[model samples]
Target: MKIDIVSVFPEYFDVLNLSLFGKAQAKGLVEVHAHNLRDWTHDVHHSVDDTPVGGGAGMVMKPEVWAECLDELLGLDSSTSESTTEVDDVSTDSTAAPVLIFPNPSAPLFTQRDATELSHADHLLFGCGRYEGYDARIPEYYRAQGVDVREYSIGDYVLNGGEVAVSVMLEAITRLLPGFMGNADSIVEESYTGANALLEHRQYTKPAQWRGISVPDVLLSGDHGKVDRFRRDEALARTNEIRPDLIERLDCASLDKADRKT
Candidate 1:
């Protein structure tokens, strides 16, 4: 995958070069570039934000600056006419055109399913908004140009900038890419993954007994059937207690008699 991030504080992403993400880059599994949004500015101050129109507290990012940067990155001409069609979802085909994303606090929450879907994209361009956020027309204009524009919020809270939200989303999306992790199976059974979307059951390592707390006996019995059942029940109970919303969304057909009992 090819990722292009536009942010005023590009240096904040330097740590992307230090962990598994770095290894993915080294192995040619992904390519990432962070660009300073000010580079697109023409003024002496290279200013990228201005006081909001009508009335507002913080400055809103300039649309002209974002348009220039995004146009160049998306390979679109500055004067290109807008298309009538608009895309509503990210295309899963790796050969599809690049998808444009913006992190917005009022947008739909980003989920693991979104991560799974975007992992197939060939290229992703992210515009990290700052201050009061970018002018709303930026995404509207792109959508009219037939770009697969997506706006997502990581959670319910607010942040000072989109940089951190972009980081969180980028990690979630990239780690699901093929060959990004050493153990692919680990991704399959994780919380919010698979058809069930339940929270993961607890895990224990060797030296099962510690501080008078012992690992479940079923885990040590060498009985695969009983072990799986115990884990499934625990997963159901945990999700029911902590995230009943996920449980409520579960399909009736996906749950067997055993799961229904849990």
Candidate 2:
């Protein structure tokens, strides 16, 4: 997949190119790019923000700069505002439209379900903001032009900027892409597998007996069928204790009679 990011603080992405995403790139599993938004600015100060119209406390991102940048990226310019706009490396696939998402604190929380869907994307573009926040209607502006603009948040609390959130999101989504990991089943068998639940089923390692405890006999028995039953119970019990809401959402009909009883 080819992913792009437009941000004023493009330098913040250095760590991405040297981490898991970096490895993904080295393996040719993904191509990630972070572009400076200012490169699309025309002002002497290379200004991309200004005071809000309603006398707000912080600056608002300029819609014009964003329009120009997006037009260049999407190759939709017919009497467009930019003179040097280039559509160089954006990938094209016969199967899908490009996805453009913005990271914001007020948007819906992302989940493993969303990550699974994003793993199939042919191209993705992330919009990162600084200062106070994005213009209230900036995302809408692009949406009006038929861009696949979506605003998503990491969680409830706010961070210094959306760059960190974008980084976190990118890592999560890209790692699920084909060929991105040593074992593709690795992600499937790990946390949030099959559903949006947190953490995989409990696991145990060597030394059947510890100081004052012992491994579940069902586990050591080497009976795959019994082991499966044992794990399902352990997972249900742990989840009920730590995050009951997840269990509440599980359809009783979805489980076998034994799982429902557990």
Candidate 3:
């Protein structure tokens, strides 16, 4: 997979080159790059924002700079503002056109479902807005051209910019990519995975018992069936106490007799 992020503070993504992402890049499992949005500016100040037309408190990002940056990344002529712009023939596979993403607090909440869906994209282009936010026309123009433009918010709160949001989203998507992790089963069993979407059960290791604390007896019984049952019960209890919303969405068919009692 290829990911391109256009942000004024490109240096903020330096951390992407470390840890799992760094290893993914080294193993050729994924490719990630950050481009300075100002590179597309033609003015001396390299400004990417302007005062809002409606007298807003903060300046809005300039659509022109974003257009130029996107054009360059998508292999279109940056100087043209024509709405017919399309991603250059990416590959023989028609699905290779890059999917554009805009992160905003007002957008639909990003979830594991979104992460799983995005992990399959051929390429992902992120538009990180700052100050007041993105010009409404930016996404409008792209959508008008039939481009895949999606806006997502990580949570309910607001952030100073989309850079941190992008970083978070990137981590979620990257970890699910094939060969990114040593244990593929981790993805299948981890918290928030589709129908079984519940907080992972508490885990313990090492001496099992410490300072009068002991691991669940079921875990030490060498009985896989009993161990699995204990974990499911713990996970259900945890989810019920924390995020009952997730439990409410579970299918009726998935609720066993024991689970229904819970």
Candidate 4:
């Protein structure tokens, strides 16, 4: 997969080269490029923001700068802003058209399901807004041009800029790509994964007893069936107590008699 990230503080992503993500890049599982948004500016100061039109506290990122950067990255002609082609729905096929994403505080919350969906895209272009945020028309214009533009909020709170949000989202999305992890099954049963979207159950390592706290006896019994049942019940109870919203969104049809009782 190819990822293009535009940010004024491109150096912030240097950490991407130090972890499992670095390994993924080395293995050719993904490619990431961080571009300085100011590189697209033509002025002496290379300014990328301006005062808000209506009256705002902070400066808003200029749309023209973003447009030039995004146009080049997306391979779109700046002259064809009126393209009337229909935008395609997000698909799981890696050959699908590229996805344009902007991190917005007011947008729908980004979830693991979104991560799973985006992992299939062939290319992803992210525009990280600074100061007050980029002009809203940037995404609107792209959508009009038939781009599959997406705006997502990583959480309910606000941040100084989109760089951190993009980092969080990028890690979530890329780790799901094929060959990104050593154990594929580990991703399947993770919390907020699959259809359940429940919080993951607690885990314990060897030495069973730690700091006087003993691991669950079921885990040591060597009975896979009983162990699985114990973990399922624990997950159900934990999710109900910690994140009832996930339980409320659960599909009734997906729950079996055993799950229902739990």
Judging by lDDT against the true structure, name the best candidate.
Answer: 1
Instruction: Output the lDDT of residue 8, model 3.
Output: 93
Q: What is the C-alpha RMSD of each candidate to the true structure, in Å?
A: 4.5, 3.8, 3.8, 4.3
Query: Which candidate leads the pack in TM-score?
Result: 1
TM-score of each: 0.91, 0.85, 0.89, 0.90
Sort every candidate by TM-score, greatest first.
1, 4, 3, 2
Across 1-262, the per-residue lDDT of candidate 3 in tens digits comes to: 8889999999999998899889988887777889999999999999999999979598999899999888778656655565654454243332566799999999999988888878778789999999989899999998887789999999988899999999999998888877888889637834466766888899999788899999989999999988988998998999999999988887677778888776
- Write down the lDDT of every candidate, Cα atoms only: 0.88, 0.77, 0.85, 0.87
Q: Please report, as a residue range, the 10-residue window in candidate 1 with the lowest summed lDDT.
A: 84-93
Give the local distance difference test score of model 4.
Answer: 0.87
Better of 1 and 4 by lDDT: 1
| lDDT tens readout by residue for model 2, 33-68 | 889999999989999898988796888788888878
True-structure lDDT of candidate 2 = 0.77
Q: Name every residue pair that clashes in candidate 4.
A: none
Q: 74 in model 3: Cα distance from truth in Å?
A: 2.1
TM-score of 3: 0.89
In model 4, which range of ten residues has the least summed lDDT? 82-91
lDDT of 1 by residue, 1-262 (tens): 8899999999998999988999999887778999999999999999999999999698999999999999988879656555622253333557458899999998999988888778888889999999989999999999999999999999999999999999999999998887788888637734465456988889999898999999999999999999999999998999899999998888777788998777
Candidate 3 achieves a global lDDT of 0.85
Query: Order the candidates by lDDT, highest first — what do you get?
Result: 1, 4, 3, 2
